[model samples]
Every structure is written in structure tokens, then in C-alpha cells.
Target: MKTILVTGSTGQLGNELLQLSHLEKDYRFEFVDRSQLNLASEESVRDFFTNKTSSDYLSIINAAAYTAVDLAEKDKHSAELVNVDGPRNLAQYAKSIGAKLIHVSTDFVFDGNHSRPYNETDLKNPISVYGKTKSDGEDSVLEVNPDSIILRTSWVYSQFGKNFFNTIARLSKEKESLRVVADQIGSPTWAGDLARVCFSAAISDQSGIFHFSNEGVASWYDFAYEIVRAFGYHCEVIPIATEEYPTDAKRPAYSVLNKQKFRKTFEVQNVHWKERLYRLVEEVKGQKLT
Candidate 1:
């Protein structure tokens, strides 16, 4: 069995990937969270690979990142450390051992500029510190190993981790009405869908940048409305403009990605946003722990 290393084992997507261990019997997996390996420290990163190489691990799936989008504005250094420097270290190590690197990135790199969905070829113009650092991370990975696969996704949510879906699901119970930004529109990708996509891409002939997200576009308000309905709640989802719900970062009005490259290259298809959301709700309901 081929052994693969998965970073950020505790994250939303990483946790989802762990559940697939039974489903993916061909690959033997070793999971690592920040406590297991620190990407920011080159010595720690170097040491992690040094040990992994001793075991002859051949691939790395970098799912760890400092994903606090709003907080990144104030915590730029920490974001850059984890998002940029960490990946650079991993890329360098991956290149050294001829290991394939699958790096997860965000759609925030494109400042919501285009009318249509963004393709892999679209120019990146990140407006927020979080996006800037993530884009930098992508460049570093590609620079070190051209064979690396970088998956750019958007509005990632899951039943496992801290995300928009569960946050709205929780908050709806406390508040009679919730206000969400309506101007911004993009795909609400399930972490499970993305995790499977990552596994497929890493094992396949595909190597390069790919956009993975659930099919169909929606605003935060639209997503919130769906979540409230899924919870069987009667809370009103108020659609507010971006200006009304202002943040430090300037979010793109539309950041939908055109996933033609991923679909064609990896032969992987994404489910619609609504179906993915429904299934996630079901999963959450099953656990009964959330």
C-alpha cells in the first residue's frame, strides 16, 4: 500500500479526508496536525520530512492553513507564516524527495472581478491579507515543484469543522433573524467533495492548478437561508448588501470559479451546492454530537 502524509488532520477538510480511510483502502494514511508538525519552522518541517523519508512516504496533502479570513488582516505575519512559509518548506521538501504535493488554496486570490466564473488562467489580484498569503503559498509550491497540484476552492463548509454552514446552523437557534451579505456570490463547496477531489487528483495524471467547488453560485444570504431550512427552523434570513455588513477586507462581488480544467483533467465532477448542503446536514444529524 502506498503511504501518504496528510497535514492539518484536525481541519474541516482533513477531518473529512480521515473518514474516507475505509473508502480508500489502496492508500495507507498517516495524519498530522500542528502539534505533530509545524510548517512555519523550517527545522521542524525539515525534521518531519527527514523522519517521513525514513519511512519512504511518497506524497503529501497539505490541508493545514491559517484560515481566519477576517482576523488575517490583523494577524498578517501569522497568516504569511502558515500560509506562505509553511508551504514553501513543504514544497522544497517534496521536491527533494521527488514526492507529489497537493496544496489546497482559496478563490479569494481573484478579487471577484470577472462577470463569469474564474478559470485557472485568470489573473490573481488578492485584496485581503488572507488571500495574498494564500496566493503567495501557491506561487511558492509551484516554484519549488512544478509537478505540484494546487486546488483553489471557495466558501468551504463541512459538518466537522468551524465553517459557515454549522455557524449559521448554530446562530439561527439563538437569533430570530440573521443578516448575511448578498452581494458576494460563489460556490459553497463541501469539504468532503474537495477532499475526494484532492485524493483523486493526487493519484491521477493531473498536476497543476485546479479549481474545485460545488456547482452553482450563491451569496452568504442564500447559503444561510438554505441552512436554516435544513435545520427545520423558521428564522428569517435577511439579505444585506456588502456595505451594510462591512469588514476590513474588500471581498469580491463575484468569485465563482470555472472548474472546466479540474473536470476535464481529473475526470472528477462536483455536485450541486444544494445537494452537498443537504447531505452535510444529514451527516450532522447522524452524529448527534454537534
Candidate 2:
């Protein structure tokens, strides 16, 4: 069986990946959360690789990242330490051991200036600190090992973590009205779907950048409205422009990623975002919110 080491095992997508590990007849997956392996430190990351005992077709699926967009603006160095240097160290280790490096990235890498969906060949001009760091990480991974695959995802949410969908569900139940940005548009991705795609890419693909997200596009308002409607809830979703509700970091007005290259290469069918959203709602309906 193939042995895969997953970093950031406590994240939304990382938790979803662990769920898939129950039926582990085909592969053996070893998970390491931040407490176990601090990717931000070279010594810590090096220690992880040095202690690995399994050599059965090794693959490192790095899902760890510094994803606080607003905070990243203030903590630029900390962001680079985890997002850029962490992946660089992992890539270097992967190269040394001839292991496949599958690194997760964000859609923020694009400047969101294009009218149409972005393809894999699109030029990146990230405007925010978070995007810049992730873009730097992508460069580091590719520069170190040509055999590395960088999967850039957008607007990811899940039932297991602090995501837009869960927040909308919680706020909708508690409040009469909710305001979401209507100007920003992108594909709403489910972390579970991305997890499956990552697993496939780790086992099958050669090296290159690919875009993966649930099919279709919608703004934040559209997504929130859909969530409440799907769950048979009565909540007023108000559409507000980005300027009306500002954040420390600028978001892409349009970051829709085209998954044609991924579909063609991996032969994996990416489902529509709404379909997965329904499944998430069903899964978390009974869970208590703090």
C-alpha cells in the first residue's frame, strides 16, 4: 500500500481527508496536525521527514497554510514563514526522497481582473499579502521540484470547520437579516470534493499547476441565499457591495477557476457547488454551535 503523509491534518480539508482514511485497504495515510509538525520551522519540518519510517511509495500532501487574509496583511513575515517557506522545505524534502509533493493553494493568487474564468496559464498578479505569500509558495514548490503539483482552490467551505456556509446557517437561524457581498464572484468549493481530487492527484499525476473547485459561479450573496433556501430557512439575505463592507485585505471580484485541465488530466468530474452544499447542511444539521 502507498504511504501518504498529510500535513495540517486538523484543517477543514484535512479533516475531510481523514474521514476517507477509514477504509484504508488500498493506502496508508499518516496525519500530522500543527501540534505534531510545525511546517513554519525548517528544523521541525526536517524533523518530521527524518523520523518517517514508512517508505512505501511516499507522497506528502501539504494542506497546511497561513490563511488569515486580514491578519496576513499585518503579519506578513509569519504568513511567508508558513505559506512560502513551509512548502519550500517540504518540496526540498520530497525531492530528496523522490516523493510526490502535492501542495494546496488559494485562488487569491490571481488579481481578479479577468472577465472570464481563469485558466491554468493565466498570469498571476496577487494584490494582497496572503495571495502574495501563497503565490511565492507556488513558485518555491515548482522551482525546487518540477514533479510537484500545485492545486489552487477558491471560496472553500465545509461542514467540519469555520466556513461561510456554516456561518450563514448559524446567523440565519439567529438573526432576521444577513448581509453578504454581491460584487465578489467565484466558485464555492466544498473541501470534501477537493480532498478526493487531492488524493487522486497524489497517486496519478505528473507535475504542474491545476485549478480545482466545484463547478458553476456565484457571488457571496448568491451563495448565502442558496444555503438558506436549500435548508428551508426564512432569512433575508441582503446584497451589499464590497465598498460598503470593507476588509483589511482586498478580495478578488472574480476568481472563478476553470477546472478543464484538471478534469482532462485526472478524469475526475467536479460536482456543482450547490450539490455539495446540500450534503454539508445535512451532515451538520444536528451539531451544536458555540
Candidate 3:
């Protein structure tokens, strides 16, 4: 069986990929968290590929990243190290060993000024440190390995991590009223859906940038409302503009990504955001009942 190395094994997307790995028996997986393979350290990355595994890997899925948007502003060095330098090292190593590298990126790479959904060909003008670093990481991977595939996604959430869904669920149980930003618009992508896409990209021969997200658009308020309502909570969710909520990082007011390229290239059916959200909410509720 072909071996595939998955970095950031404990993260939301990484965990989802691990859960689905059993379905694909053709490929053997080596899931490594930061302790096993530190992407932020160049020496660690080199030593890992050299001595850690006995056989060569067919592909390396780089799911690790410094995803703290607000913390990235004060901790620019750490963010750049993981988001930019780490991917560069991975790409270089993948090139030397003749392994395909699938790097995950964010929709924050765009400035969100466009009136319509962003396509792969759209110009990137990142407004935040996290966005700039991720954008730079994408360039680094492609520069080091022309065959590398960069998958950009938006508003990623999952049951495993600290995400909007769980946050709202917790808040709904704790508070009677909640306020969410309504001006910023984007699609909430379930990490499971994205993990499947990443796996498909890893096996495919296609090499380029692609955008993937759950179908449809929604504001943060809409998302929060759905989460609360799904859980049968009585919390009043109030919609507020982006200006009302101040943060260290400047978020894109509109970062919805177009899925035409990804759908056409991968021939994968995209799930509607609401349908996936409902399924996930129901699953979480079921787990709690048990």
C-alpha cells in the first residue's frame, strides 16, 4: 500500500481525515501531530522524513497551520513560521522525495472586496497577518514544487476543535442573548467535507490552486442563529455589523469562494451548507443524549 504522511493529525481537518482513512484501504497513512513532526522547525521536518519513516511516502498532506486570526497580529513571527516557512520546507522535501504535497490554505488570502464569489484566478490582497502569511505559504509551496496542490477553503468548523458551531452551542446553554457579526459573509465549510476533498486532491494528478466550501452564503449571525436553533436553545441571536465588533485582525467583509473549479476538476458533489450543518448538529445532539 502507498504511504501518505498527514501533518497536524490532531487538528479539525486532520482528525476528520483520520476518521475517514479506514474507508480508503489502498493507501496507508502515517498521522503525525506537532510532537511527531514539527513543521515550524526545519530541522525537525528534515529529520522526520529522513529517519522517522522507513519507506518513502506517496504524498504529504500539510494540514498544520497557525490558525489564530487575532493572535496572529501580536504573534506575527510564530504565524509566519508555521504558515509560510513550514510549508516551504514541506514542499522542498516533497520535491526531493518525488512525493505529491497537498497544502491547505484559507479564503482570507483574498481582500474580500469583490462583489461576487472569488475564483482561483482572482488577485490576492491579504489585509491581515494571517492572511498574508497563508498567501505567502501558497506561493512558497508552488515555487518549491510546481506539482503541489494548494486547496483554499473558508469558515472551516468541526466537532473536534474550538469552532463557531461549538462555541455558539456552549454560549446558548450559558447565555440568554448572543450577538454575532452579520456584515461579514462567507460559506461555513464542514471539516469532514474538506478533508475528503484534500484526500481526493492527494490522489489525483491535478496540480494547481482550487477553492472548496459548502454551497451557499451566510453571515456570522445567520450561522449563530442556525446553531442555536438546531440545539433547541432559546438564546436571542442579534445580528450586528462588522464595525460593531472590533478585532485585532481585519477580516474580509466578503470571502465566499466559488466552487465551480473544484467541482469541475474533482467531479465531487458539493453539499449545501445548511444540510451539512443540520446533520452535524443532530449528530452532536445525539452524542450528548447518549
Candidate 4:
């Protein structure tokens, strides 16, 4: 059986992909973290694939990333090592071995100045160190391996890791009210949904940049409100301006991506953010998910 090597197996999307591993029975999934194949070191990547033939992986889903947006500004070198050099190394190896590389990127690649949704072909003008590294990573992947598939998603969250959802969900239980930035707007993406799309891209012949997110858009405050309501948490979610919650890095005011390309290309549809969140809460309640 061909293998699907998934990096960053501990991440939210990585774990989500692992949960769906049983769905693709024909392919053996090799889920590796930093210990197995550290993307930052080219030597580590080469050593990991040493003695292995070109037919080993059907696709290498690069889910590993240095995702701390604000901290990226303070530590540019670390971010570049993981976000820039990492994908480049992976793409080089994938190209040499004739393997497809499916890379997960971010909507942060755009400056978020547009009132309309961003298409796949939009010129990226990332405003933060994190965004720039991710953008550079995408370029490296495409340059090294033209056959790579790049999926630029926005505001991703899940049960496995720390994200907006987890933060708000926890705060809702502890505090009586929560304040979130209402100015910054973007669609929230569920890792499970994105994982399903990654698997589809892996098996399909598609190769290019595509945007993926939930059906509808929401501000941070809107997302928080829905989260609190989902689990029957009585916390009041208040809308606050971006100025009130200042961060080290600047954020895009509107970064919602156009998913027409992704949906039409994959021939798949996604649920709205609210409905998806509702379903997830209902489904995970029985599993003892916090």
C-alpha cells in the first residue's frame, strides 16, 4: 500500500486527518512529528527518506508550521526555519522522488483590505511576519515542486489545539462575559472539514492554490457568541474594537477567502460556521471533549 506521510501529527488539522485515516483504507498513513521528520533541517528530511523508493508516499501533507502570529515578529528566524525552509525542503524531496505535496497555508497571506472575498489568484500582500513566512513557504513549494497543491485557509480551529475556539470556550465557562475583536472579520475553518479536503486533494489530480473555509463569514465576536451558545454556556460575548485588544502583530480587518474555487474544484460543499460548530459540540459532548 502507498503511504500518506502527514507531518505535524500533533496539530489540530494533523489530528483531524489522523481521525479520518480509516476512511482511506488502501493507503497506509505515516503520521510523523518533529522527532521523525523535522522539516526545519534538510538533512533530517533527506535521512528520513533515505533508502526509501519514490513510490513510498502518495502525498505528503505538510501540516507542520510555526503558527504563533505575534511571536513570529519577535523570532523571525525560527518562523523562517519552519515556515519557509521547511516547505522548501519538503518540496525538494517530494520533487526528487515524484511525490505530490499538499501544503496547508493561511489566509493571512493577504492584507485583508478588500471588502469582497479574496480569490486564489489574488496578489498576496501579507502584513505580518507570520503571513510573510507562510507566503514565502507557498512560493517555495510551488517553485520546488510545481505539482504541489496549496490550500490557503483562514481562522482554523479544532478540539486538539489552542485556538480562538478553545480560548473562547474556556473563557465562557470561567468568566461571566468575554470581549472579542469585532473589527477583524474572516470565516472560521474547522480542521475536520479541511482534513477531508486534504485527503481529496491527495488522491485527485488537482494541483494549485485553493481557498477553504466554512460557508459563512463571522467576526471574532460573532464566533465567540456562537461558541458560548453552542455548549449552553451563559457567558455574554461582547464586541470590541481591534484597538482595545492590541497585539504585537497587525491583523487584517477583512480576510474572508473566496471558496468557489475550492468547492467547485473538489466538487464538495461545506456547512456554515454556526452549523458546523453546533454539530461539533453535539457530537463531541459524549466523547468527554473539553
Candidate 5:
């Protein structure tokens, strides 16, 4: 069986990918946490491939990244280590061994200046530390391994992590009103859908940048309202401007990605954000009832 190495096995995306192991019977998934393979340290990454697994990796899915957007401003070094250096190391290693590498990136690569949806051909103009690091990461990966696939997504949320969905659900119980930024707009991507795309890209011959997100655009306030309504939370969702919520990092005002490239290349179904939110809320509620 072909062996697939998945980094960040415990993260939102990686965990979602783990659920698909049973379906792809032809490929054996080898999961690893940070302890087994630290991307920041070249020695660790080098040692992992040298001694850890005997079989050559058929595909490598990199889901690990320093994702705290606000925290990234204060922690540039850490962010660069994982975001830029990590992918660079992986790309170099993947190239040496001829392994198919799929690296997960964010829409932050673009400065959110575009009035239209961002596609793979869009020029990257990162406005924040996190965004800059991610942009650098993408360049490094492609510089070493042109065959490597870069999957740029935006506003990702899942049941596993501390995301917008969980935060709204929790705060709604405590606060009667929830204020979310109304100015910034982007598509909310379900990590499960992203995980499926990662697997698809890994198995395909197509390589280059691809944007994947749930089909539809929404602001943070719009997303919060939908979450509260879906979760049956009684809190009133309040729309506030970006100035009201000051952060350490500057967020893009718009980051909706055009999925025509991904759809054209992979030919996968892209679900709407509202529909995904409903299903996820229902899934969580059902799990709670049991």
C-alpha cells in the first residue's frame, strides 16, 4: 500500500483528514505530531525522514502552522519558523525524495484589496506578519519544489479547535449580545472540505497554487449571526466596525477566494458556507443530545 505522511495530525484540518483513512484503502496514512517531526528544526525534519519511517512517502500533507493571527504580530520569529522555514524544509525534503507535497496556506497572502474573488493568479500583497510569513512559505515551497501544491484557503473553522464557531457558541451563553467585525469579509471554509481537497490534490498530477473555501462570501458579523442562529443561542449578534475591535495584526478588509481554479482542476463539489454551518451545528447538537 502507498504510504501518506500527514503532519499536524491533531490540528483541525489534519484531524479531519484522519477521518478519511478508512475510505482511502489504497493509501496507508501515517500520522505524526510535533514531537515526532518538528518542521522548524531542520535536524528534526531531516532525522524524521532518515530514521522514523522505512517506506518512502507517496504523498506528504503539511497542515501544521502557527495560526494565531493577532499573536503572530508579537511572535514573528515563531510564525516565520513554522510558516516559512517549515514549508521550506518540507519542500526541500519532499523534492529530494520525490514525494508529492501539499502545503496548506491562508488567504492572508493577499492584502484583501481585491474587489473580486482572489484566484491562484492573484498577486500576493500580505499586510500582516502572519500573512507575510505565509506568503514567504508559499514562495519557499515552490522555489524548491515546483511540483508541490499550495492550497490557499480563508476563514477556516472546524469542530475541533478554538474557532469562530466555538467562540460564538460559548460567548452566547454568557453574554446577551455578541459584537463581531462587520467590515472584513471572506469565505468561511469548513476544514473537512479542505481536508478532502488536500487528499484530492495529493493524488493528482496538478501542482501550483489553488484556492479552496466554502462557496459564498460573508463578514465576521454575518458569520457570527449565522452561527448563533444555527446553534440556537439566544444572544443578539451585533455588527461592529473593524476599528472597534483593535488587534495586534492588521486584517484584510476582503479575502474571498475564487474557486474556479480548484473546481476546474480537481472537479470537486464546493458547499455553501451557510449549508456547512447548518450541518456542523446540527452535528454538534446531535452529539450533545446523545
Candidate 6:
């Protein structure tokens, strides 16, 4: 069986990939968290790859990233290390070993100035530290290894991690009312669905940048409202403007990505955001019963 190295094994996407690994019996996956493989330290990353047998792994799925948007402003160094240097190191190593590199990125790379959905060829103008670092990471990866596949996604949530879905679910049960931003719009991508796509991309020889997210667009308020409803919570979800909910990081008002290229290239149909969220709610509720 071919080997696939998955970094960030403890994250939402990493856990999803682990859950789906069983379905692909042809590949042997080695999942590792920060403790096992630190991306911040170039020496650490080099040491990990150096000790491994050459050509033992067929691909490296870099799912690890410093995704704290607000905190990234104050913690720029750490973010740059993980977001930029880490991918560069992985790409270089992958190039040396003749292995494919599948680097996961965020939709924040583009400033939400466009009125319509963003395509892969759109120019990137990041507004926040996190976005800038991630954008730099993509550039670094491509420069280091042109064959690397950079998958950009947004509003990622999953049942297994601390994300928007779980946050709304917990708040709905604890409080009777909630307020969410209605202006910031993007697609809510379930981590499980994203993981499956990543796996498919890894096995294929497709390179360059690609965008993937659940079909349909929604604001944060819509997302929270759906979560509350799906979980059978009676919380009053009040929609608020972005000005009402100020944060350290300035997020794009709209960052919806066009998935036409991804769909065409992969020949796969993306599940609607509502349907995926309902499925996740059912799964979470079922887990509670067990």
C-alpha cells in the first residue's frame, strides 16, 4: 500500500480524514499532531522527514495551520512560521523525495471586495495577519514545488472539533437568545466532506490551486440559526451587522469561492450546506445517545 503522511492529526479536518481513512484501503496513512511533528520549527520538520526512509510516503497532506484569526494579529510570528515556513519546508521535502504535496489553505486569501464568487485566478489581497500569512504560504508552496496542490476552503466546521457548529449548539442549549453577524457571507464547509475531497485530490495528479466548500452561500447569522434549528434549540437567533460584532481581525464581508473548477476537475457533486449541516446534527445527537 502507498503511504500518505497527514499533519495536524488532532484538528477538525485531520480528525475527519482519520475517520474516512478506513474507506481507502489502498493507502497507508500516518497521522501526526503537533507533538509528533512540529511545523513551526524548520529543523524539526527537516529532522522528521530526514529520519524517514526516502520515497516511503507518496504524498504529504498539510492540514495544520494557525487559524486563530483574531489572535493572529498579536501572534504574527507563530502564524507566519506555521502558515508560510511550514508549507515551504513540506514542499521542499516533497520535491526532494519525489512525493506530492497537498497543502490546505483558506478563502481568507482573497479580500471580500468582489461582488460575486471568487475563482482560482482571482487576485489575492489579504486584509488580516492570518489571511496574509496563509496567502504567503500558498505562494511559498508553489514557488518551492510547482507541482503542489493548494486547496482553499472557508467557514470550515465539524462535529469533532471546537467550531461554529458546536459553539452554536452549546450556546443554544445554555441561552435563550443569540446574536450573529448577518453581513459576513461565505459557505460553511463540513470538515468530513472536505477531507474526502482532499483524499481524492491526493490520489489524483491534479496540481495548482483549487477552491472547495459546501454549495450555497450564507451569513454567520444564517449559519447559527440553522445550527440552532437543526439541534432543536428554541434560542432566538437575532441577526446583527458586522459593526455590532467587532473583532481584532477584519474579516472579508464576502468570501464565497466558486467551485466550478473543482467540480469539473474532480467530477464530483458537492452537498448543499443545509443538507450537510442536518446530517452532522443527526450524527452529533446520535453520539450523545450512545
Clashes of 1: 0
lDDT of 5 by residue, 1-290 (tens): 87889999988998889988878898899899899999999999999877433257888999999999999999899999999999999998888788989999999999988899987898899999999999999999999999999999999988887788778877886799988999999999999999889999888888998899999999999999998889887999999999999999999999999888878789778889999999988888845321
In the order shown, the candidates' Cα RMSDs to the true structure are 1.4, 1.4, 1.8, 1.1, 1.9, 1.6
lDDT string, candidate 2, 226-281, tens digits: 99987778889999999999899999999999888888889676778888888777
lDDT, model 5, position 38: 97
- TM-score against native, each model: 0.96, 0.96, 0.97, 0.97, 0.96, 0.97
Candidate 4 per-residue C-alpha lDDT over 1-290 given as tens digits, one digit per residue, 9 for 90 to 100: 88888999999999999999978798889899999999999999999988766678778999999999999999999999999999999999988787899999999999999999999999999999999999999999999898999999999988878888888878898899998999999999899999998988888888999999998999999999999998899988889999999999999999999988887778666899899999888876645334
Evaluate all candidate structures by whole-model CA lDDT and list the values in order: 0.88, 0.89, 0.91, 0.91, 0.90, 0.92
Question: Per-residue lDDT of 187-232 in model 3, one digit per residue for the tens?
Answer: 9999999989998998899999999999999999999999888889
Backbone clashes under 3 angstroms, per model: 0, 0, 0, 0, 0, 0
- Report the Cα lDDT for candidate 6: 0.92
Error of 5 at 20 (Å): 1.6
Q: Is candidate 1 or candidate 6 better by lDDT?
A: 6
Q: Which pairs clash inside model 6?
A: none
Where does the lowest 10-residue lDDT sum fall in candidate 1?
281-290
